[model samples]
Target: MTIHTTSSCTAFEGVRRIASGALRDVAAAVKRAHDRAGGEPILVFDDATSSPIEFDLRGGVDDVLARLADAAANGAGAAGQDDEPAAARSRGRPKLGVIAREVTLLPRHWEWLNAQPGGASVALRKLVDAARLARADNERVRLAQEAVYRFMTAMGGNLPDYEEATRALYANDRARFEQMIAGWPGDIREHAAKLAAAAFCEVT
Candidate 1:
C-alpha cells in the first residue's frame, strides 16, 4: 500500500538507531549512512504506521526529496479501502473526496436506514460518525497495538523472549510486557515502549 504521513519517522541500521525526524531529513540521513561502507542495512519506518517507507535514494539529496514530494502529491489516496470496482462506487462529491462504496446489509437493516429522514446514505454516514466518536479510546489502543506489533516483527524478531513478549503485548499486561523485553538492546526496548504508549493506556 502506498502510504503517506506528515509525522516523524525513525531509521535503524540493524539494531542501532541512525536517525529519527522528518521523513525527508531521515531519508537524506539514510543515504549518507548507506554510503559509509561497513554499516548494517538500513530500514526507515513511518512513525504513524511502523511500515518501512520505500523511496529511491539513488541520486543526490535534492533528487530524493523531489521524488518524495511528487509521491505526496500523487499519494495513491488512503490505504485499506474496499476493492470494489470503480463502476460500483459512486463519486458523490469529487471535490470533497467523498467516495460512495457499496454497503451490504440485511433487508431489515436497509429498511431502517431508508426510513431515516435523509435516507440510507445520510443515515449511514451519521451512524458511522457517532460510532467513531464513541469508540475513540478503543480505536487509539488498537492502533497502538498494531504499530508496536509491526515494529517488533521488523526489529525484535530474533530477540530473546520474543514470543513471550508478543503474548504479553497483546494481553495488555503492561508490566509483563516490559519484563519480557527487559534484556533487549536499550534502543530497541525504549522504542517498543514508545510505540506502545497508547496501547497500554487504561481504556474504559
Candidate 2:
C-alpha cells in the first residue's frame, strides 16, 4: 500500500501568525521576517503536527531558500514511489511482514473464523483490512481535529474565549468555533480554520 502525505507549515511573529503555506513558502517567510525584524523570535511550526521546526537562519535568506527548494524537489520525487518492495507470495504464508501473535478469543469465535474461507489467519487479516478501510475517514477526521486543537492551544490559548473555542472544536461545531475566534488576528484565525477544515462536516 502507498501512503500519501501533505505537508504544511506556519510561521509566527510573537502572538501573531505571519505566514502559512508550503514548506518553501513558510521558510521564505520566516527568512524574510528574520532579516527584516532582526533577532525577534520568529517561530515556525508544522501545521499538521503543531510542532516547532528549527531552521538555520544564520545562513541567510538565500541559503534558507536553497535548502527549502532542495527539500521540496526531493520530497516530490520520493512521494511518487512506494516505500516497500513488491515480492511474490508463498503458498501458505506471505512475506509481507506477517507477525505471529497470540490472540485469545472465545471458542465460538475461533470456530467461526476456522469455518471461513482460508481459515482463521486469512479471515482475520481480511476482517482487519476491511475494518481499517471502513474507519479511514473517521480516523482522518479525528487526526485533523487533534492537529487543529494542538495548533490552537499553542497559538490561541491566550486569546479571548479560549476555553469556549476548545469546546467548540471538540464538539465539531464549526460555526461556533468560527464565531469564537472571529475577533482573533486574521492570520491566526485563517490558519486555525484551515487546520480544522477537514474535521468538520459541511453544514448544508
> In terms of TM-score, which candidate is strongest?
1
For model 1, residues 72-131, the per-residue Cα lDDT tens digits are 766645443567988997667557768978889999999999999999999988999988
Each candidate structure's TM-score, on Cα atoms with residue i matched to residue i, is 0.69, 0.63
lDDT of 2 by residue, 49-107 (tens): 67667766668778977766666567778867865556643457656787999999999
Candidate 1: C-alpha lDDT: 0.85
Computed on alpha carbons, the lDDT of every model, listed in order, comes to: 0.85, 0.79
Instruction: Quantify how close model 2 is to the true structure by its C-alpha RMSD in Å.
Output: 7.3
Best by lDDT: 1
Error of 1 at 35 (Å): 1.2
